[model samples]
Target: MVLTNVEEQMSLRLAVEDFLFEESALLDDGRFREWLDLVTEDVRYVIPVQTTRERAHGSAGSTTMAHWDDDYIGLEMRILRLDTEYAWAEDPPSRLRHFVSNVRVRPGSEPDEYEVRSNVMVSRGRGDSRATDLLTAERQDVLRRTDQGFRLARRTVVLDHVVIATHNLAFFF
Candidate 1:
């Protein structure tokens, strides 16, 4: 059966949402290795530093400083560190729950690519702690269509809070 333009768009949107949900699940389940497969070899993942500024000024996120600005190699190194016994920060491993919402998908500048914007709220709980730290952010991503599926090409995470309350950022977003 042939599909109309709208139908095709709807299908693509659903696929993007599914991809994001699956990625979140992988992170929540602490399956970093599996998650790595979802990104392209030259993927650029960044989380810019957020600050409070006056209304007259520009955006709150700074262009210079970043909490995380990593390429595929850097990401792989982080995952490798997590796998070792010496990575004391994540020795116990935090329980995580990633909630993705408000997904908007549109055509990217490049062919076979989609620009996706979404809101994410991550709940993280550490050892013997009933209290859960919440991290909320808006993510802009570029997903490229491939034979396997849609793979993350680029991602820029803008956090809601200027001051992070969490002990450590050992988990992926």
Candidate 2:
């Protein structure tokens, strides 16, 4: 049966939501390598520095200082480092959970691309540590539709907090 434009768009949106959910699951499961495959070769993942100021100042973030700004190669290096025994940050490995919600998807300039925005909350706890850190943010992502499915082309994370409350960020957001 032929689908109308609206129906098709809705289907695409739903598909993107499923893709995002799967990605979240992978992260929570500590499947870093597998999660990397869901991104494009030229993927840009960045988290800009958030600041607090008067309303007249405009936006709350500045790209000049990024918490994380990485391309495919950089991301790969980070993933590789996680495997090293000396990677103290993740030596014991922190238990993490990624909660993604409020997903919104729309068409992009490219026919096979989409612009997606979502809210994210990451909770983490290290070995023998009673304290848990919660980091919350809003992510703007560009997803490209490929033969296999949707792959992340770019991601910009804008944290809600002006000052990061987490002890260390050793895992991907």
CA RMSD per model (angstroms): 2.4, 2.4
Candidate 2 backbone clash number: 0
Per-residue lDDT of model 2, residues 1-173, tens digit only: 23369888788778988999999899888888999999999999999989887999888898588889999999999999988987898878889988999988877878888889999999999889899999999999999989999999999998998878777777888
How high is the CA lDDT of each candidate model? 0.93, 0.89
Looking at candidate 2, what is the lDDT of residue 95? 91
lDDT of predicted model 1: 0.93
lDDT of 2 at 104: 85
Per-residue lDDT tens digits for candidate 1, residues 1-173, read 23359989899889999999999999999999999999999899999999999979989999999999999999999999999998898879989999999999988988888899999999998889889999999999999999999999999999998999998777788
- The residue-level lDDT of candidate 1 at 25 comes to 93
- Worst-scoring 10-residue span by lDDT in model 2: 1-10
Query: What does the lDDT come to for candidate 2?
Result: 0.89
RMSD from true fold, candidate 2: 2.4
Worst 10 residues of 1 by lDDT: 1-10
- Tell me which residue pairs clash in candidate 2: none
- Could you tally the backbone clashes for each prediction? 0, 0
